[model samples]
Target: MARELTTLVTGGKFYEGPRWHDGQWWVSDFYRRSVFTVTTDGVETHQFDVDEQPSGMGWLPDGSLVVVSMKDRHLVRRAPDGTVGHYADLSSVAGGHVNDMVVDDRGRVYVGNFGFDLMGGAPMGPADLARVDPDGTITVVAEGLHFPNGSVITPDGSTLIVAETTGAGFVAFTITDDGSLVDRRVWASMGDVPDTTDVMEALGSGLPAPDGCTLDAEGHIWFADAVGARVARVAPGGEIVESVPMPDGLGAFACQLGGEDGRTLLICAAPDFFEHSRSVADEAVLLTMQVDVPHAGRP
Candidate 1:
């Protein structure tokens, strides 16, 4: 049995990027273009606007914040002076808006995107993966994906597993020293869940493809299953082991384990869509749960 986390934030249009920083979990509100910091007791210190669709966020070695603006197709770095600068332009390789991402231990950033006009009616090419090295050079790692959304790197930095949100599965790839991918294989499949289409399927029925994720000390992946409204823990063998529950019964977008103790499961959840237009219930929210396992990063 799993514990159902209560709502930490309600009536949010959309939420993504649950990251631990500055003594709080800083998250991006995708549809609202705002960033929020939530304390442990569910008190939000602030919700500041960033003026762009920020999907993912990272921290530089020097203590600056790096943000991924999807529609802008730019990697932004929030300087020590709190000014945002364009760190890299990824529009050439990314067909459309960038989505979720994972920054590896060595400072390489792997970005995923909505390649073919997923919900915006502005169709593009097949989905692709972009890699930005420490020198700010952008490289295309993989392409022809259905919908590359959430991702996480292995603890050892030798593997990066990405979620193909629309294709109904996840792909594990071998990460090269230069931040390229080879030996790509299906790490996990959605296993034919109902109400899920082949492409970026609808949510709210507990069946949409996965979106955001993080790992535990045991190397188990706790991925946000969009429509499922649950953060499912996937074992190293790629099996769904323990599922942490949600409040809205909607899409649990992305998740990460962070905090001083590194045992808190922070989740970004929102309502789902069918064909990107039809909506079920507005169950969008942010939730958290205390788990027994420590986070992979801290381990």
Candidate 2:
């Protein structure tokens, strides 16, 4: 069945990193070079800007905001008083341009990367998951991931599940006390990993192509399918319990389950994604739908 979607915001160059916090939906407009918060009724207030373009967003235990500066490979920090500064320099450790991230209660951040020159259409390669300490130290948590994109942490902060786009599965890892990721295993395998270096070829090879994800109270994960144009509710071990197709066949890039009751699923949709085209167009939108289960775990 088609899930009803209500538009909360429109006219974006390209929307990514849909997050819910403090009674509003926060998202990054990749081409607009800015982040904004929107209420359920479509009211929007601009937050801050990132010249290099922003992708992922998370908050620290102190309530300060962290934004990913994709092109420059840096993490930008915004304090409660609205001051923005450099949080961490990831260029040296990140395998490629940084993408999405999830921060634990202790301010330990686990970040993903493109692993290749995605916008330039460079040959696809594996990437690394980096852990940025609260004190600004960088460490490679895991290496050789096939384009690790969206990620989430268990409620206890002991386990992490990351969506590997090219790998066609969700990868799991053990989070150590020192913030290192170990015990690498496949949480869910949708299909065999393709050997092609081309992104399109890998995505078209009958795989899930999972991207941004959110965890629910039942421990099921709702992940956006970048190539399938839908949001899939996946149980552990590769079971796709449900899939909510995007309205008008739009592509669902990222989703967050947040609201007063933590059941509102906000989805970021676009006609398509290509840095060159999205940078010059405004076809992205924010859509919302209520779900049965409330959200659980860290984003």
Candidate 3:
């Protein structure tokens, strides 16, 4: 069945890292360099700001907010009291800009990065997934990922799955007791990996480039198909069970399953993803659609 989408909010530069927490929809605006929360009825509020670009977000057990500072490669923490500080730095470990992350129940954050200078037109390269402990110790848990983007952990916190935007599929790993990722395997293979590392060439390959995503109760991953202009729900074996195409002229870049009943699928839609275009144009909007499966697992 086709799902109809409704506009939730507009006039944002670019939205990413969306999550449902504390009864509100929280998201990061990369070009706006700020984080905002939207109510179920579309009331938008500025939560805070990141001097550099902000991507993914998650909350700690103590109620502090952890956000990925993309440009500077740091995890910025905002305490419940509104005090902000640096939690961890990935400058020395991250190959390029740190992108998205997922925080486990123990507050261990798994983060990924771009393996090359994306905006500068450098060829794409493999990146590493790093785990940040509660004490701020950073360890490279997995390596050789092609543009690792959004990620999620199972409800039991025993497995981690990440989207390899350039690799054309999803990758999974078993999470050991100490938060180490092992048993690397392909969770879903959308298509063959592109031969070229050039961003444009890879995007033109017609493969499903999974971006920010969320897990549904039935263990299906709802991911934004970056170049497909749609958000697709895929089962574990790479079957595209369902898809929702973006409205005309808009491209889907990220999505999250959230709502009072966890049935609302929030999509981040924009005209294009070029930094020069998106950073200057406020053409991005957040759209929502109703889904049958409620959200599950750690974002």
User: Estimated TM-score per prediction?
Assistant: 0.86, 0.98, 0.99
Backbone clashes, each candidate: 2, 0, 0
For TM-score, candidate 1 versus 3, the one ahead is 3
Poorest 10 consecutive residues by lDDT, candidate 3: 191-200
**Range of the 10 consecutive residues with the lowest summed lDDT in candidate 2:** 1-10
Off by over 4 Å in 3: none
Instruction: Tell me the spans in candidate 1 whose CA falls farther than 4 Å from its real position.
Output: 121-125, 192-208, 273-283
Expressed as tens digits, the lDDT of each residue in 15-35 for candidate 2 is: 899898988889999999999
Candidate 2's TM-score reads: 0.98
Model 1: residue 43 alpha-carbon error in angstroms: 2.7
The whole-model lDDT of each prediction reads 0.74, 0.90, 0.94
**lDDT winner:** 3
User: lDDT per residue, candidate 1, 74-166, as tens digits?
Assistant: 888877887767888888888778888888877788888888665665543468898888898888889887678778777888888887766
